[model samples]
Target: MARASVSPAPPRVSAPDLPRHLKRVEPARGADLLQATLHLSGDVDLAHSSLEQCLLTADAERVDLTGATVLDVAAKDLRIASMSLRNAGIRRLRITGGRIGTLDLSGSRLDELEIRDVRIDYLTFGGAKGSDILIADSTIRTLDLPQAEITRMAFVACRSDEVDPRGLRAKDVDLRGLDAEMFTDANGLRGTTLTTFQIQKLAPAIAAGLGIQIKD
Candidate 1:
C-alpha cells in the first residue's frame, strides 16, 4: 500500500497591533465628543451627539448609534483601524481627510455620508441600507457591498482598486467622476446610470468580459 501524503499547515493569521492609548471605555449616552482619542470595545451607542476631531478605535463588535451625527472625525495621523457600525441611524455623517482600515457598516441607515479626501482599505456594507452615499476625492482599495441596498450612490473624483458588487441592489448609481480599475462583476451595474465619458473608459473591460474582438 502506498503511503498517504500529509498537507502542510496553513500560515496563522494575526490581528493588528493596537496602540497603547486604545483602551476600553464607554461614552455617556448622547454625549458629544470633540478632539478626543478613545479605544473602545464591545457595543457603543452614541445616539444624538456630535463628534469632531475624534480618534476612535473599536473592537470587532459593532458601534451602535440609534440616532447620531458625526462630522469631521479623525484619528491620530488621520487613520482609523478596524471600526464597525451597525444599526446606526446617522444624520449628516461626514468623514473628511482620514485613512480607514476595515470599515464595516451593517444594517445601518444614513441620511448623508460624505467621505472626502480619505483612503479606505476593505470597506464593506453588508446587509446595510443607505441613500445618497457619496465618496469624493478619495481612494478605496476594496469596496464590497454584499446584499446591501443603496439608492443614488455617487462617486466624485474618486478612485477604487476593486469594487465587488455581488448581491448589491442599488438604484441610480452615478459614476461620472470615478476611476475604477477593476469591477468584479460588471453585470452587477446593469441599471446604473453613467455618463458617456465613463462608458468610454470602461469599454475595454466590458469588451473583455463579453469576449468581443474590436478590429480597427
Candidate 2:
C-alpha cells in the first residue's frame, strides 16, 4: 500500500511537435492559413481570421470560428461535423486524428491545448480561460466544462460518459483519466487529480453528495 498524491501535481502536457511538410490549404477560397495545411470540403468560415502556424486537414461538414485568432494551430485528419468557436482566441492548439460531432468553445480563450486520437461526440468549454491543456487518446461522449478557468489540464487515455464540470476552475487538474459515468457538478471536482482507484470509486458518490453517512 503505497499510494501517495496529495493532489496538485499534473502539468507536463506535451503534443505539438508540428511541421511535417506543410503548404497546401484552402480557407474556403479566401486563402491565408499561416504556415498552411488544410483541405476543405463543405462549410467553412474562418470568422475573424488571424491564424498562425496553422494546419487542418480533410473534410468539414460545418465550421464557423466566430472570432478566430488561433495561434500555432493543428487539426490533423479532421472530419468535423459542427465546430463553432464562438469567441475564439486559442493559442498553440492541436486536435489529433479524426471524428468530431460538435465542439463549441463558447467564450473561448484557451492556451496550449491538445486532443490526441480524437472521437468526440460533444465538447463544450463554456467560458474558457487558459493554461497547459491535454486530453490523450480521447473518446468523449459529452464533456462540457462550464465556466472553465483551466490552469493545467490533463486526461491521459481519456474517456467520458457525460461530465459537465459546472464552474470548473482547474487549478492543475488531472483526473487520472476518470472515464466518468456522469457528473454535472461533483463540486466541480474542486482542483482535480484523482487516483487511489480514482478516489475509491468516487467514494460512494462522494459520500452521497456530502450528506456523509458511511457506516453501512
Q: How much lDDT does each candidate structure score?
A: 0.64, 0.79
User: Residue-wise lDDT of candidate 2 within 69-172, one digit each (tens)?
Assistant: 88887778688899888788888788898998998887888878888898989999888887778888889899998888888888888888888888888897
**Model 1, total clashes:** 0
Q: What is the lDDT of candidate 1?
A: 0.64
lDDT of 2 at 190: 91
Local error of candidate 2 at 54, Å?
28
- List candidate 2 segments past 4 Å from native: 1-43, 49-59, 68-82, 88-100, 108-120, 128-140, 148-160, 166-181, 189-203, 208-215
lDDT of 1 by residue, 147-210 (tens): 7887767787988898887788877667666787777776666646667876776787788779
State the weakest 10-residue window (summed lDDT) of model 2: 25-34
| lDDT score of residue 113 within candidate 2 | 82
Model 1: how far is 47 from its true place, Å? 10
TM-score of 2: 0.33
Q: Residue 110's C-alpha lDDT in candidate 1?
A: 57
| Each candidate structure's count of clashing pairs | 0, 0
After best superposition, candidate 1 residue 139: deviation in angstroms? 0.5
